[model samples]
Target: KIETIDVTPLNNEQSIQASLKAFAQFNRDPYQDPGTVMRHPGLLFLSEIGEVKQQVEHINALKDELVTRMHTLNARARNTHVKMAWRGVSALQLYRHITAVDYAPRKALFSWEGRTTSISRPHSKEEFIEIILKTKDMCPAHVSPLDWDDILRKEILYIQSVQENGDLVRMKPVAPHPRLLLYKTTDVKATDTIFSNVPTFVKTAPDCTIVELTSFDFSKTTTRRKKRVFIPIVERLNMYFRPFK
Candidate 1:
């Protein structure tokens, strides 16, 4: 079972302090009031922004052994290159709630090629989001979805708490799932995701602060046809370059 790490008692290393200083400098907004920034709809996210390397290193320092263990597990399972998906800091203020929903590949949940599945009928992304939202209402705020028999019969969902300072929630790499976090007290949090076997290119900006990935990838089974196999990757790369143009 995965458990949250309590970093409150741990002393910050020199490198961590330096990284935090740089991060604060880069993310500082002169126009916004410091008092109200957390209340804004667009909360500052720590990932994919300034200094990807620095951010990853910061997270590693926070939980070095756990990060190494994840890399080892991914290598054993996927036998492919491992990459940092994203890493960042989150400030969860008191009484703030975050909700997460499980994400499955659409092909897994919806019927395809007229082959009906037990999960549900074919639906678009919008419809799927609607279904998930409805499910969120089915349970009380404090109850975890794992306890809901009806939801469990069809899908898996759960709620976990990370209320204290230095509490780290670790999730294994399995399927892409969303999360909901409720902060009972003000807490500064760090989170990261590492992925393997994802076919895409990551390029940092000229300043070496921001990292962006080509959005397209092979989500389907490979075919013997050369054109079909390679065209999508070419197109995806082309798409990634469009911003430069």
Candidate 2:
């Protein structure tokens, strides 16, 4: 069975102290990645602190390994469980794992040269919309109908596609938009969908942080061994993107 390791303790004691002391040199830059820490002089000095060089090196190496594993676990935890149908085929249950935290919003910047010069405000709708568009291009799904006329036309076309080609075409399944498209897909009885409460990003448009995570299951008998998919983070942000009640 897969298990989870409580990583909070990993950040609790002396290890965390070392990390902080090293990070202090960088003024605790919120955007610093693991590579940034390695290149920083203060962090490198931890290994040369008196006779702790060799031991510190070993600990650091282990920490790196632990961090990699933790990333995988975090990705799995953020995974979405849902049923996806392609071209009217039987819906395939999938565990969609959304990775790359760097894609998330940056922390509020509150200082500059020891003086607060700028502050983070809710990001603009255009930024979120851009992200959404890029995500849709990557996931590309059939255009969802907006009104009854559109729906009726799409339904009719869907039938014609099957009759003409003996398969679904034109009216096809598109990549999920997380916020809008997913609800319709899971509006079925076969799959149990769950959306967790987690802030993917903070939005300035509505002055509220968007907090919601979608989860899905993985199949052990699927024909595809491995697949990579991207989830549009803006779908959630759009929920709080202002102008909407």
Residues 114-140 of candidate 2 have per-residue lDDT tens digits of 111111234443433343444433321
Candidate 1, superposed: residue stretches over 4 Å from native: 1-20, 23-70, 73-147, 156-245
Clashes of each: 8, 7
> Which residue window of length 10 is worst by lDDT in model 1?
236-245
**Sliding window of 10 residues with minimal summed lDDT for model 2:** 110-119
Q: Which residue pairs show backbone clashes in model 1?
A: 46-88, 51-209, 98-180, 98-181, 99-179, 99-180, 100-179, 100-180
By lDDT, the best candidate is 1
TM-score of candidate 1 to 2 decimals:
0.15
Q: How accurate locally, in lDDT, is each candidate?
A: 0.27, 0.26
lDDT of 1 at 197: 13
Error of 2 at 33 (Å): 9.3
